[model samples]
Target chain A: GAGVSQSPRYKVAKRGQDVALRCDPISGHVSLFWYQQALGQGPEFLTYFQNEAQLDKSGLPSDRFFAERPEGSVSTLKIQRTQQEDSAVYLCASSFRTGRDGYTFGSGTRLTVV
Target chain B: AQRVTQPEKLLSVFKGAPVELKCNYSYSGSPELFWYVQYSRQRLQLLLRHISRESIKGFTADLNKGETSFHLKKPFAQEEDSAMYYCARSAGGYNKLIFGAGTRLAVHP
Candidate 1:
């Protein structure tokens, strides 16, 4: 694809429902990242992947949040038992090399937990 | 711990006026800093980086290690420059970027 792509631009989930967000990074990009942006706040790191390896998951807020990049091409973020605080914009970004190389961000999926 | 902070939530200026957007960061290790901008209906994109030391669209930011700041500045603001700006820090040699709250720049004609 021309740029990083995310699906379900917006998601409305029940308080206890589970939702999945998908991301298709730039073709052949080596690194992928997931971030969550709360209202009036900047995007905060959620997880990172190098190829198919999940190297960093330190930023994941809770056990309910899980992300995977099975083939190192496309990734998925799953939230279990979504809460009101989980409502935010989920952004996916990819970098050709490392963080020093900069990143290309997707439009993001806005999740609204009602 | 690495953290980025943009003090002003909103900045208003008339077109052609000089504009400065403040950014401050705290990181014990050497950090890679960047400024990202988002125009209406556009994805977030990199505007400049401390490592690049290059200006984009006449806007430049100098990383001041002593002050722990990387403030974006432009000689004259343009109406087209109105957007949301974020300051970010990259540390730990990872592909993770910690971003600030962001500043909304309003360049009025």
Candidate 2:
């Protein structure tokens, strides 16, 4: 794809429900990242992947937040037992190398936990 | 330990007025800073990086290591420039970015 792509632009989940968001990064991009943006706040790093290797997961807020990039091209972010506090927009970004190359961001998935 | 702070939640200015968005970061080591902008209903995108020292859309940011600041500035604001701006710092071998709360710029005509 010419740009990073995210699926299910908006989602509404009930409390305790599990939801999964998807991201398709630019072709052959070597690094992918996941971020969460709460209302009125900047995007916060959730996890990072160098190719298919999950090199960092330090920013994931809790164990309920899990992200995987099995093939390094596409990634998935899964939230288990969603809570009201989980409502936010989830963004996916990919870079050609690392931070020096800058990043292309997806439109993001706005999840509303009701 | 890596933190970015954008003190202003909103900044309003008339078109053609000068604009400056303040940003500050706290990191012991040398940091890579960037300014990202988001137009209404648009995805966030990079505006400029301290390393690049380039201006985009008439906006420029200079990193001040002594004060730990990277402030975005424009000579004349444009109506189309109204958007949300974020200041970010790369950390952990440039693997991740820590972002500030963001500042909303309203360039009115």
Candidate 3:
């Protein structure tokens, strides 16, 4: 792909429902990151991965938010029992090296929980 | 705690006017700063980084460790430059970026 791709550009989920967002990063990128952007706010870090290893999950808001990059190419972000506060845009970025190089961001998934 | 602050929520200017979006960060150690831009209905993209000291679309940002600021500036604003701008800092270890709330720039013709 020419750039990072994310699935389900928009999603509407009822409170307590579960939603899954997918990200396919640039082929062979070494680092993948997930971020959440609230309305009128900047994107906040959610988690990070180096290759297939989950190097950092400290940014995940809660146990309800889980992200995995099993193969290092594609990743998924899952939010269980979604709450209204969870409504926001989820963005995925990939970099060829550690972030000093720069990151390419996906279109993002806008999730609305009602 | 590491944090980025963009004080202005919106900045309006006439085309050809000078523009500056303010940003400040609080981090324990030396940090790398960057400016990201988002156009209407488009994905977010990198505009410039302090380390690069390069200008893109006539925009430049310089990291000021003395004042803890990284402000984006342009000599002449363009109508096409209307977009949302974010200031971010790279965290030390994991390299995750901490972003400011964002500033919306509106350039009118």
Candidate 4:
């Protein structure tokens, strides 16, 4: 792909419903990251992956938040029992290396929990 | 804990005026600082990093260790420069970036 790709650009979910956001990273990129951006705020790190390995997930806000990149090329973020506070933009980024090389961010998925 | 701080939520500048977006950080060890910009309805993109020490689109940022600041500056602001700018700091080693609340730059003609 020319750049990182994310699915379901916008989503509306009722509180307590589950939502899945997908990300297709640049081919062969070694690092993938997920971030959450609240209204009027900067993106906050959610998790990170190196290849197929889930290296870090310390940033995931709660047990309800889950992310996976089983094959390394594509990733998904799943939120269980979404709450109104979970409404935000979820961004995915890819880097050729460990992100010291800079990142290319996707358009992001805007999730609204009502 | 590593954290980035961008004090101004909004900055308005007339065309050709100088522009500066303040960024500061708090990290225990050495950190990597970067600036990312997002145009209206566009994806976020890297503007520059302190490690590169290079200017892009007339914007430059210098990392000040003593003050823990990495402020982005442009000598002449253009209308096209209107966008949301984010300040980010990478935890040492192979870590993800921590971003600050963004600053919206409005460059008016």
**Against the true structure, whose DockQ is highest?**
4
The deviation in Å at residue A21 for candidate 2 is 0.4
State TM-scores per candidate. 0.98, 0.98, 0.98, 0.98
Q: For candidate 3, lDDT tens digit of each residue in B1-109?
A: 8999999999999999999999999956878899999999999999999888999999988888999999999999999999999999999575789999999999999
TM-score of the second chain in candidate 1: 0.97
Would candidate 2 be rated incorrect, acceptable, medium or high by CAPRI criteria? high
Question: Where is model 2 more than 4 Å wrong at Cα?
Answer: none
Candidate 1 CAPRI assessment class: high
Off by over 4 Å in 3: none
Model 2 chain A: which ten-residue window has the lowest total lDDT?
Answer: A95-104
- Candidate 3: residue A110 lDDT (0-100): 97
DockQ of each: 0.87, 0.82, 0.85, 0.87
lDDT of 2 by residue, A3-50 (tens): 999999999999999999999999988999999999999999999999
For candidate 3, give the lDDT of residue A2: 91
**In DockQ, how does model 1 score against the reference complex?**
0.87
Q: With candidate 4 superimposed using the best TM-score fit, by how many Å does residue A10's alpha carbon deviate from the native?
A: 0.5
Best-first order by DockQ? 4, 1, 3, 2
